[model samples]
Target: MRRLTAPLPRCALVLGLLLTPVGCAEPEKDKVTIMVPWSGTEFKAFYAVVKDFERDHDIDIEPQVTRALTQQLDAAVAADAEPDLAVLPSVGAIAKYRQAGALSKLDVDTHAYVQPLRGLGMNGKDVYAVPVKADIKSLVWYDARLTARPPGSWSTLRDRSDHWCLGLESGPTSGWPGADWIADILLADEGVGPYTAWASGEGRWDKGPVKAAWTEWGDLVAGARKGAATFNFRAATEKMAKAGCSLSHGALSAMAFDSAQVKTDGYTYVPSSRGALQVSADFVGKFTGNRSADEFIKYLASPRAQRTWVNEPGFALSADNRVTAYDNATQGRIAAMLRSSRYTLCFSAADAMDPDVSAAFYRAVLNYTDGKDLTPLLVALTRVQRELGYTHPGSPPPPGPLCSPPNHP
Candidate 1:
């Protein structure tokens, strides 16, 4: 029987069908399907592991790839046709799913895994999803050819203009990069307490640290050294790759080390190099009635599987070290930065707000590109922040009487 290691190739399927027997005993009935959210090369890399899963367990596995993974899962569950496992990118929903009885808690000993991943499972308790791929976001990528060493803090980043470039123009998520800017400033200047409070909705946007975060970002944007408003992430990244740009901020996954235009040695990586690292938690949901579904989940958390699937070469970092993983020198530096993060928070894109609220923030930012008033933008954010219910994770509910909600003109 052919071994499965990664995503199945179409050619392999044809060969499998052709080789199956005349009077053969029916194949062992271990069959499963796994769903994931990302597309393109990412899907390809993850599918590699799916191939491996099937080979080791004598399982016949199918992969369902979709861009709207959350929506697809919801539709499937509603139709009572949910797959055995689904990969998600939200811990808030994971908590809510457990509360809603929609997901089973990952019941197993995780003693051998990394300690930081304990809460990473379900609802501060049950282990539901085993982390697969992780990108450390606190890293600052700089052109070593130009600056040699990048600045450490927000102050240094803003004041020292030896060289800096940021692609704030990621479409759909253009404002998201701006959000990262705000998040990092808050994390660096105020610490986790204030950032957590804000994330949990108990903290006010106009409060000192929150305001300071916005002010800092505003000051940076309006500073002496300016970034191209129209440049998307790729442009800034390309510049950094060619050593034309001195510094850029992004996740470890953003820059590929082998890009032809990039002079690999020109890049330097660091944790908190840009700001406090935030994570986009990806998880898998269980809905299969198969007795062996538990086995699959356990394997996902196993050291052997982790090494082959999650931590394998060319793949991104996994949250826990179920097994040793390797990366090239540049990627290793990025991983080191992620592994050493002190203040890891969820990305704002993962914040529990109506997508429209986020859209509003984005629109306001795009308007700011045209030199719109900062006060109006702040006022709009305060409203959006209030109405959408800003919040923090792992914090006690706010104390004292509630203040009157702010209004936007």
Candidate 2:
């Protein structure tokens, strides 16, 4: 016979139900998915901010990393499987998605950012994207030991190509470094008027300043390493000391040098002459109408978050003026330049072109680097630009200025 058990009291039974194991477990967090192209140190810096956000809110951030962000994002949008947020690397992509209705309006405050940075993702009154990270492409970093002073002009630097550490390879975006060189040279030599016209798809590529800019860049890199076309940009940057090259022209973030090295006497950078700086930003845009995603994006653009990100190991810069301090004097100075209205900050030309046109421009850069003629290449690029008119026929131009001047709207 089984032993008899006593019946539970009603009070005890109620207490047991109230203290159920399921209810004792932690509640599930709202997950916000963000797709980005950063990895290694860049990803680490970004993740640190994400972790901080996770700690302060009852939300979980799921980051999907990809090197080919453009292609992957396109595929995701086509499949109706877009992430809650995505970091768009180019203004062109941002406009494309915005026009396609894939991106949602952002409600973050952008008053702290300067002109084009503030307007990069706007379509009339709607805010579609916010710049999360900025790169000052108009900087030329050099080893002070080898070069007494940075070149006073682009022409002076052009003839010293042998002392330059140039690399064109960056996977799918291999030719972008070359592109930046050309854009910066054009902007510096010709000023903002022609630069803006060419970048806005209103100017011809096969003639005048655009053609001259390409020719100049080709001459500068004519003596670059034989394997530069295939050399990884980061590796090329890191190998500068070993290669006996004293000068490297690009953003500080692309230098791939240690923070300690940057702080040393040997490493230094000078702003590109003439006060025309080529800059680019990784813009974050919302894809889904999730509240968590909105909060995440707002937080990412916040001054506090921007500060945290810039101080991290990767040495990212912020477009937000409120993010005033930096990890070091070098970074602080650069950040100040970005916020200053005294200098005209121009968006990357290829980045402002249509996506198809931008890719074609990249290919042209590579071919030119490989000793191919530039006239036919420019003509071919112009044809691509003409075929994919920047906007629909009779439609107003895409929102935002391609180049920002002092006190610009």
Candidate 3:
């Protein structure tokens, strides 16, 4: 944290007390509160960014708890007591608020960020938000010794199927793992069109591409290939690491390699031809009618702010592709993957989707992987997607040509 060096004069301090009540003194700078779903190390990094901005501008940013953004923001909107800004962690929320007219227009140039990231904050001619953080998904973490050459194809991936340490359990969110597998398969097989259609409540699960994702997962788990379906994501990844499992099919963070406190050679992006990747994004939205909020928005898109956030260990990669001075080789590889044209850039289809719709998909994946017929699940999913009337306009389309599935690696 940076400290201001100059001392205040006695007369100035006396005047400050006269103008403002003791112990409740007015702020020296305009206060701008921002709510976002960030805690722990991520919050520290976020505060660092805000501190840097505060030093440059006449504003103080207050970070708040982000437990109920939609409900709370709605209440605030009704009361007309909304905060200056908010950092929604998903594309769907950003789109929903913008469509509801809760966001104010801003001139923040999003092109300073990555190409795909720019789309998350769009509402046609107006830019409703600016992406502040992003996590590249669609990844594969492996045992460095085992993956020295790293298998380049699904065939090579499944060849070591028996050695996989698999699990689909996540307590209440248990089905997310299964859903990720299906979503990744959809991304690899259907490309961006059908994959994104499903995400935005515009696609049907009974379709060929959706069905294909479900069936392939079934084949992988057929006859105990997926032995552990009750362990949550963290447990599964840690188990895989300890058991020397061949590969964990998810993002860099999904493996919990950095958080696990275990030593190993870092992770790498699986080649595009062989697998798919997703990017979890944090988008900044404005509400208060304050110019300071607008200035903060522009600062967020600048390299100075992003540079601070990227320095936090295991923090998500910056949405700004132009900045890449990570502190470690693993972070560098993940950032490089985001910058590369060879890898597919996709969002969590479920994350960008309706909560109920995403939940249904997770449950369906779990049931289907646990040996239930996929027909009923797919039909149910299709019905739910149709019922989720709200639309999410910015869910990205596939980055390149979709490769047909069975992409194990």
Estimate the TM-score for candidate 3: 0.77
The stretch of ten residues in a row with the least summed lDDT in candidate 1 is 400-409
TM per prediction? 0.74, 0.93, 0.77
Which parts of model 2 are misplaced by more than 4 Å?
1-19, 252-254, 391-396
Cα miss at 36, model 3 (Å)? 1.8
Return the number of clashes found in candidate 3: 6
Clashing pairs in 3: 137-278, 138-277, 138-278, 169-232, 170-174, 192-398
- Per-candidate RMSD vs. true structure? 11.1, 2.9, 8.7
Per-residue lDDT of candidate 3, residues 1-409 (tens digit): 1244344466688888787775586557888888775555667778888878888787888887665555566678789888899876556666556666788888887665555566656756578888788776566666665455446554355555445446777555557766777777677666777887766666678768778777776665464445466755566676655754556766533435654332235444364234446666778899978888888888888887787778765456786767888765566667776667565566677767655566677788777766677788888888876666344334323221122111111
Candidate 2 lDDT, tens digit per residue, 1-409?
2333444466688889988977789998999999999988899999999999999999999999999999999999999999999999888888888878899998987877876877887787678899999888888887666666777578887756346787888888888888888999999999999998888888888999999998887777667747788877887778766655767888853448767768764677887756778888899999998999999999999998998999988878898877888867787887788767679888888888877788999899888888788899999988888877474363335547888762466
Which candidate has the highest TM-score of all? Answer: 2
Q: What order do you get sorting by lDDT, best first?
A: 2, 3, 1
TM-score ranking from best candidate downward? 2, 3, 1
TM-score of 2: 0.93
Pairs that clash in candidate 2 = 170-174
